[model samples]
Target: MSRVSDTEPCGTETAVRSTRPKDLTSRSSFGVLGTLYSAGEQGLALDAHRSLSRSTLLRLRDRRTGAFIEEFTAWADGFGEYRVRLTARARRHYAHHHACYRELYPDIDTPVPRPTDGAHGGLVDHRADRDPARNLLREADVLVLDALIRLQGGEIGRLQKPPIGRYQRGTSPEIGAMPPGLLYREAEKLANSRKPISRLLQHPDGPLVAVVEVTSLLPWAATGSIPLPALIVLTTRGRDHYESHLDSYRRAYPDLDLQLSRHTM
Candidate 1:
């Protein structure tokens, strides 16, 4: 394995500037080194598992104290893996979801929800044969998954762009007006396009900021092992609510390069 080190002083400015758009496009996979750096952690080592592949292991440390923080691994397919030591506050948030998972699926062996798990991720059962719920849980996952596929496919500039005009909410001032039930019908059409998978984390109590933290500690996917970065799009109100609790979210999901965007309409 070959090891690449950045021993010079590390900070968010340096890290962001170092990561060129070309790097994201050219690499077969990406690691959390840049994420950690942007989070104010120093990357101690960036090692390649093989010279020819994008698989890598990154070690991070505290920039001020030089204390070891954590390690992140990215596979050649662009799927990222990492184990994080959650803080007390983060554990409190996770505890609620963990308990809910156990209550909802008693027979499932998975102890905790992971974003990559086909069944347990997003705290929802995404099987096509399963009975549909009255809630919007399934629809939310479909929306996010469709958005990711489009974003990765270069069909859109950001996640906020609606995949189709029908998906746009008429209530939004930016979208003007639309026929009644138009958005709902379009969503159903999008949902019917593919087998459902868990791609969103929903918390009944408030904004999705807490669930965002849970996703950061786990591998994210739209379907199967397809590699895509963690990205969230919210309405104007949702974005404001998320920003209001930004500090807590930051503490819970430190060292994550989560992309956030607001809906276009």
Candidate 2:
């Protein structure tokens, strides 16, 4: 990727207009840009150059390992542009092991009386909000995400879980001979057997500010040299506490604007 000139800082209007992707709208948020999202990049890239008739998958690789990690699908945003949508299930299941940002106005609390006085200049911190533990992973059995994320200025490393096996459900030949309701009845057992829903984060370990990248369709908006939060809360797939109360916060503390990070790390 080429670097932006100092005369036009990144994320600025002039910077955006000079290098807008063919399909993106100036009104669209960076999260809708789609190019930086590995999972949706190809389809977004194709759409940026031309147009795509249908949606497609874009794979996101491990930032540390360069290994195939997870994927997301990309389709048109119905505004003559392509973007990625985060399904509730996918967000609950796959969003994790990444870094995010949060901005604190001078009014927010900080160790420094002047929140802007430190090297961070804006009180930057790293937090890992998702990524569940593999089964049977005791605290001693691993380098947990909470600890790993707080690890500053270190060499990057990779961690892989052993192949996870999932049980397949199939109707017995005798049951197959019956009407489909029989299989539907059998499905109840499987449904009841599913693991309970979990956000996969421990108390006091998530980002103090909201993690916006999990929902990002583009990467640049949430990655690279940004100031982020330690954590506030980690909930189920769809909502974060900070996001849920954003409107109230704006009403109560009208002076602040808690914007999401500008990159998708």
Candidate 3:
């Protein structure tokens, strides 16, 4: 056997690489699984399904939709069928629900709850991110997945609300009420306060991210910011309020990729 060659560049030498056996002891798998679960949590999770069961979902949807229907029953005279189908969930959530928002519920402003200390110290707690986090994410995933499925020729699930487009003219005075100019104004107000668009220093090396109001882009689009970041919108009210805007807002910002979550509201 002809043997050694000193002229071989050190870079070209191939040594026996450490090959860890794949099994339960693999640390890498846990990390990957954690990431997958985190990603999966971005939509509604199973526990949420139990908490916000089909009955509860219908109640919330119908309550909200019914309120809208009542307000615009006359103007939306011909669209009764549409409203009935859409606002089913809203009706449930708002039905006899007398809890006023801290802001609007009581005439006096209510103090915001302080964030709690944790092992991560001010880092957003995954659990606090939502109640029954897994369930919420699963539900959201189902919502989007259903939409895509319908686009792929599957039957569309009956949406609790008839989308923004189907809202009766009477119920949605805010829609046509905003002229192009006002869209800019409202969007700017939201941008300035709840939806400020800026890069956080913590993520300087990554893709630019901004937490903006779902309505901010309405103005940006009007002002010719043709493209905007995909936003995660929040509301002070509750999850129900936030979910109401998800589809329309997602369609608004197709780029600046990310999932839209209901953080505050």
Candidate 4:
């Protein structure tokens, strides 16, 4: 993995033109190049390089953990020029709700959604107006919030009585097999609605004393120079109202590394 020289002239432009597919215009080709370049510049190392039919495969790994972060398939024309495409691994990571990758590498850029060919032979743009990175960040925060609830001896789900009527028609296997509980069903509803689950966990009368927002992701690691994530505590009452509960939580779970701050609105 050689460092791309700052002095190099039109290096990315040349690479894009060389590897550009017949269906991709120059603008889209540059977009792909930008994705690859941004990842490399953000401290991800090129871990694997292999030759494919008319292209090269490159896998980027985290230098610290040696985990595969992104994979790019680079194509070359007959004149020895290059262009890159983000393959399965990179695409799936962004599309799914998994938080490990973003938790590990928070600074890496969110990839530009790839364009696809339409039925009528013209290029169809699939660029979304939504920000995947922001969504992932909220998801990661919810996971941390869930962990905090569990640490405080709160059960996430409880058994509930089933409906009096018989099973409905066209019920999916998952729904039929679902454990009787409001938590699971509510979680599914929130997920389907693309809403954050942090709000679902809130109960003013429950053991959870305050609403929390994870201000950082670096704290997911057990040991690192990186500072722990900060928790912004929001409560209807003053901060002093929750001090006892917060202190108890800290005393009960000393291993949980978090910096707590209060913000009232």
Best-matching candidate per TM-score: 1
TM-score quality measure for candidate 1:
0.21
Model 4: ten consecutive residues of lowest lDDT: 118-127
Runs of candidate 3 with Cα error greater than 4 angstroms are 1-86, 96-130, 134-142, 150-153, 156-265
Query: What lDDT tens digits, residue by residue, belong to model 4 across residues 114-201?
Result: 3322211111111121222222223323333433333323233321123312322232343333322233334334234323334434
Residue pairs with backbone overlap in model 1: none
Name model 4 segments beyond 4 Å from true.
1-49, 52-59, 62-123, 128-229, 232-265
**Per-residue lDDT of model 2, residues 1-265, tens digit only:** 1111234323333224443322122322222222233333233333443211121122222111111223234445643433334333222212220111013122222122112211122212211111122222222111122222222113121111122112112322321121111111122222232111112333243432122221132233245354221222222321243334434432222112233311212
User: Where is model 2 poorest over a 10-residue stretch in terms of lDDT?
Assistant: 122-131
Shift of residue 65 alpha carbon in model 1, Å: 25
Tell how far residue 35 is off in model 3, in angstroms.
Answer: 45
- The superposed Cα distance between candidate 2 and the true structure at residue 129, in angstroms, equals 7.5
User: How close to the true structure is residue 43 of candidate 2, measured as C-alpha lDDT?
Assistant: 30
Which residue pairs show backbone clashes in model 4?
19-83
Structural similarity to truth (TM-score) of each candidate: 0.21, 0.17, 0.18, 0.19
TM-score of candidate 2 to 2 decimals: 0.17
lDDT, candidates in the order shown: 0.31, 0.24, 0.26, 0.31
